[model samples]
Target: MREEKLSVDIENIVKKWEGKKGSLIMILHDIQNLYGYVPRATSLQLSNYLEVPLARIYEVITFYHFFKLEPPGKHLIQVCMGTACYLKGASDLLHELRDILGVREGTTTKDGLFRLEVVRCLGCCGLAPVVKVDSKVYSKVTKDRVADILSEYEQEAAVK
Candidate 1:
């Protein structure tokens, strides 16, 4: 649910990557950062600006897991599944999330409040079972704590 379409103005972005090797990916990264996703219209504009084929732009976007084709939810919940976290009950945390949010991994909730993703590591193994909500990292998370974590964001969104 984003309401805005692709942006038509990308002159600055194009110029920054001008003449650089693999500028397409760099340009796409900036576009995603600006809009949270790569809009089809914007991609077309980029194609015309760079004189690169539309297919090539899409190829790069599709190839990278970090690039998104659609707008993301308000909050991104990343559960670290690193060795320590897994051993400490990351699987249970994932299951708890599925039950509470009614969404599968790598998907956003129906209300667009939260998106769940499982990351390989967050570099916080000492605090196993880490659940990162946007920029905030919840260390030593438990299956039971999942509800509390989500409710915090939900409440914050409601207040705003």
Candidate 2:
């Protein structure tokens, strides 16, 4: 029953792009946008519906950094690794986060509350060693503040 709904949803998405040039990427983008990440099942349905091979779907998904194969955590921790940030000890920040959260980059925590990731820049060099939790940016972050920052989120989660 659920599979049928997914098939219809994917079909509607594909119908909008059918017979169009350069539609695969656009279609994948829409799928990712809808699902937060592209489920393997939906990708297979897309392959059959579009007459495109499964390998081709994966090729594009893997090629694009924006596309995610897994659902993101409730709080996405993006640590800036730009030149200024790195020089300001972003690597140490990253390490501390991994140690504290018990999760590496591109992975969510066991509780699904946090996901760690590294980005080249957040465009806030003056605020080097920055970390962004969802839409909120924490600037000039240090290892000492890691626990406090995490605790704030934990508190919020507890309240919710």
Candidate 3:
């Protein structure tokens, strides 16, 4: 329902993928990479640019677990829940994060500082119970270390 003009970057994205097989997903991935999510305004432009139905655009976005509809927080926190991580107390780390952030998994905090998510695996089973913030991986995490991990981001935000 919003009127939007495509950004130069997105225009190029559409032009690059137009009429190509499997273009929709590729276009969507680029959009997500650009904005951290598949935004409504951008979707409108993409729909018009590709002569693709808005519903079809939404179907692909909603079907992919990786696609996000809203803006993500400044920081992304992922707790690994692979079999090894789970066995090594990944649940504890997740619960601690949820308590400290005051938001459940898959939701952003009110301040927009952090977005917490439970992931199936990080593939470092040898380093089970891992927590990743942004790109830094904290291996062998415990419930007690959650605050210190969060504090690093909070402090970084304060400095900037």
Give the local distance difference test score of model 3: 0.88
What lDDT does candidate 1 reach at residue 106?
78
Global CA lDDT of candidate 1, please? 0.86
Candidates ranked, most accurate by TM-score first? 2, 3, 1
What TM-score do all the candidates reach, one by one?
Answer: 0.82, 0.89, 0.86
What local lDDT does model 1 show for residue 154? 89
Q: Write the per-residue lDDT of candidate 3 for residues 28-126, one digit (tens) a residue.
A: 998899889888988888787677789999999998899998789999999999999999999988888888889998888989899999888898999
The runs of at least 3 residues in candidate 1 whose Cα sits more than 4 Å from the true structure, single-residue gaps closed, are 1-8, 18-22
TM-score of decoy 2: 0.89
- TM-score, candidate 1, is 0.82
Write the residue-wise lDDT of candidate 1 on 1-160 in tens digits.
2233434457788778788877888898988998888888898877776778889999999999989886788899998988999999999999999899999887888898988889998998998989999999999988788899899988998999
What Cα-based lDDT does every candidate model obtain? Answer: 0.86, 0.89, 0.88
Rank ordering of all candidates by lDDT, starting from the highest: 2, 3, 1
Q: What is candidate 3's TM-score against the reference?
A: 0.86
Runs in model 2 lying further than 4 Å from the true structure: 1-6
Could you give candidate 2's per-residue lDDT for residues 35-148 as a string of tens digits?
A: 888989888877776778899999999998999988888899999999999999999999999999999999889898999999999998998889999999999998999999
**Residue-pair clashes, model 3:** 0
Question: lDDT at 98 for candidate 1?
Answer: 89
